[model samples]
Target: MSFLNYLRVWLACARYSTVRTMMFRFDFIMWSLVELFWMTVNILLVSVIYRHTREIAGWTQYQMLLLVGTSMIMQRLMMGLFWSNLFELGRNIRTGQFDFFLAQPGNPLFMVSTRKLDLDGLLNVLVAVSVVAYSAHQLGLHPGFGDIVTYILLILCGLIIEYGTLLLIVSLTFWIVGSQGIEGSYFTLFEFSRLPKEAFRGASNVIFVWLLPVVLVSNVPSKSIMHGVDARYVLWLLGVTLLWLLIGTTVFRRGLRRYASASS
Candidate 1:
């Protein structure tokens, strides 16, 4: 299919799924309330911590809020768009259901990643943005156009890095079928992403900054907004994002060749 046609199909699928989700008003309300509660709790935690110390990990209270808010938004985006479906890749491959995806004319990865949409999670993104805006107001830090642009780019890069990392883990199912252990391990790594990487010390910190790169996903953007934009940091973030994308796509394609359908 042409690029425009592919985009149209994606939009149609998203719209239909959203309509279906809207039918469950009760579930949506409950989920939204719960998300709101969590957001409140997260903000409170930052407030309490900053009451004792002026800064945590070289960031002020407001800056930390920005970090937390941005991280929450990124998490919501992943959950709403990619997480629900990507996790099913392993099972589909094992059951031969992936054959349907293989037959699709559009990018199989894109199709699989966006097979489902969670509207509740999308709403959480709004909550996160609200927190970020409130934090910015409290800090009295008005960002410039360039800072806003870089912030947007960094957020996009963050999402891509997160999705790519999750896909890389799920792709391992090709070799390790029935690996429930992998799921737990993956979530554990993701949990680490919630905290500022600067909180970690020594080699562990080094690993997060370079190898895992989750720090760049959230902390860097928050810092850029709260502090000032650093050209070197932005360049490094772009480079890491591209590298991860290349590595992730390479790994997924290589694994595709070894994916044996259930019929085999």
Candidate 2:
């Protein structure tokens, strides 16, 4: 198919899926309420911690809220767009269903990554945005036009970092098929993002900032908003994102050749 035809098909698929999701009104409402409850619990947890100490890991109460908000946004984005289909990649590879994707006209990776969407995850995103907005208001930190632009860019970078990391993890399924432990490891990674990066000290902090790169996903953005933008941090974030993307694509392609059809 032509490029325009492919684009049209992709758009139509996304639109149809979005409309299909809207049909589940009750599900949407209940999901939103559940997300709101979790957001409340997060706030209460932070409040309780703050009561015992003036600041946690050099971050004030509002700053920590922003970090939590950023983490929540990352989690929502992953769950909504990526997580839902990630596990299926392993199954598809094991059963040779990926051959169907390979036969598709468009990019196979794009088709695989966007095959499904979890609309309920949008509730978490909305709640997280609300928390960030409320925290900004309480801090009396009105983002200027430039700040808004930078924040958007930084958040986009953060999302890329997150998605790349998750893709890397999912790609491991190519080698470790039927490993139920993979999901648990992914969840553990998610749990790590809940606390501020500063909570880690010494070697552990170095590992998170450099090895895992989770700190850049949330902590850096929170710091940018609470403190000021750091050029070095931004550069490092972009570098890490590119590195992960390259590494993930390489690993996935290597595994692709090993995928044998189920019938075989």
Candidate 3:
């Protein structure tokens, strides 16, 4: 199908999902509040840390805040857009609920990845931007249009890399059956993302930055805007993102071939 038609279907799914979640008004409000509360707490924690130290891993106070804020925004955006639906892989596979996705008109993986939307998670976006803006103000940094555009591009790349990583992890459910530890694993890995790459050392740095690449997700975007995007970093990030996307898509398709239909 054409890209336009594909997007149309996704929009329909997103609309339905938003409407369904809106039905539980109380739950939705509570979840939104919880997200906002945690975001504030995160900024506060960073504030406290900065009070004690001037910099962590070459990042000054405001820069660190920007990193944290970028991470917060990226996490909420990711969870709101793709994480929840993709993380349902194990349960869907085990309960045979994925059979319906397989029966859909388009790609089963596409259907599975985009069917649900998290309205509450998206609401946290406002808090994220506020934190970043406040941090920028504190640093007295006046970002230009070029910086803003580069930062956005970098963030989009980060999102794609992250989404690809989630797909790869969840695709393992096809082989391991009930294995969903990957979802929790992904969450745990985000700890490294919120910190500057310089904060890590030796093997830990190498592993997180090169192997897993959580640092590239948010910290890199902040760094790109703060220091001006480096040619080396941009090339490296794009390469890794492409690699992850290829790996994830290949694994998902292979896993699908192994699937046994519920009807069978």
Candidate 4:
């Protein structure tokens, strides 16, 4: 299909999700509040810690806040766009409901992953940006339009890395019985994204920064905001993002060959 046609389908799905969310206004509000509370607690924890210490792994409080906020923005985008759909993929495959996507005209991976939207997750993105802005203000930093654009683009790269990671994890359902526990592990690993890479020791640093893109995703973006984008860091992040995406789509397609449809 053409890119425009794919976009139209996505817009249709987005409209449907918005209408469904409107129907359950209370549920939407409650979920939004729950996410807001969670984000607020994270910011408060930073505040409490900074009360006693001046810096963490070479990052000052405001600098750390910028990092955390960048992590939040990437995570929020993942949750809003792909989390629900991908999280449900295991269950759908188990029950053979994944056949629905298989029958669709679009690519199965795109259809399956883009069918749902969580407004609350997207809403939290704005809140995360506010935190970043406040952190920048506190640090007496003023980024220009080009800098802001660069930061946004880097955040997008981070988002793609996150989506690819989750997709790869969920794709394991094609081989495993249940993926809930495995899916939960993604969040456990993600908790490290907000911490400065300098805070990690030898092994942890190698695993999170060098081996996996978990730390690199948020760190590179936040660092760009603090001190203009480094060409090496940008290259490294782009390389990792491309690698993850390739791995994710390759695994997903290979898994489709193993899938058993309800009709079958």
Best by lDDT: 4
Distance from true position, residue 1, model 3, in Å? 2.0
Candidate 2, which segments miss by more than 4 Å at Cα? 1-6
lDDT of each: 0.81, 0.77, 0.84, 0.90
The residue pairs found clashing in candidate 4 are none
lDDT by residue for model 2 (105-220), tens: 77777778877777778658887888888888888997878887787777777777677776777777778777655755666776667788768889978887679877777877
* Per-prediction TM-score: 0.92, 0.90, 0.95, 0.97
* Weakest 10 consecutive residues of candidate 4 by summed lDDT: 177-186
- Per-residue lDDT of model 3, residues 162-222, tens digit only: 8888888888888887585767877788767888888889998789988987987786788
For residue 88, give model 2's deviation from the true position in Å: 2.2
How do these models rank on TM-score, best leading? 4, 3, 1, 2
Could you give candidate 4's per-residue lDDT for residues 153-253 as a string of tens digits?
99999889988898899899898865556887678878889899889898998999989889999999899889888999999999999999999988989
Compose the digit string of candidate 1's lDDT tens values, residues 143-206: 8898888888888998888888888887888777776557455556655555775788889888
What is the alpha-carbon lDDT for the whole of candidate 3?
A: 0.84
lDDT of 3 at 231: 83
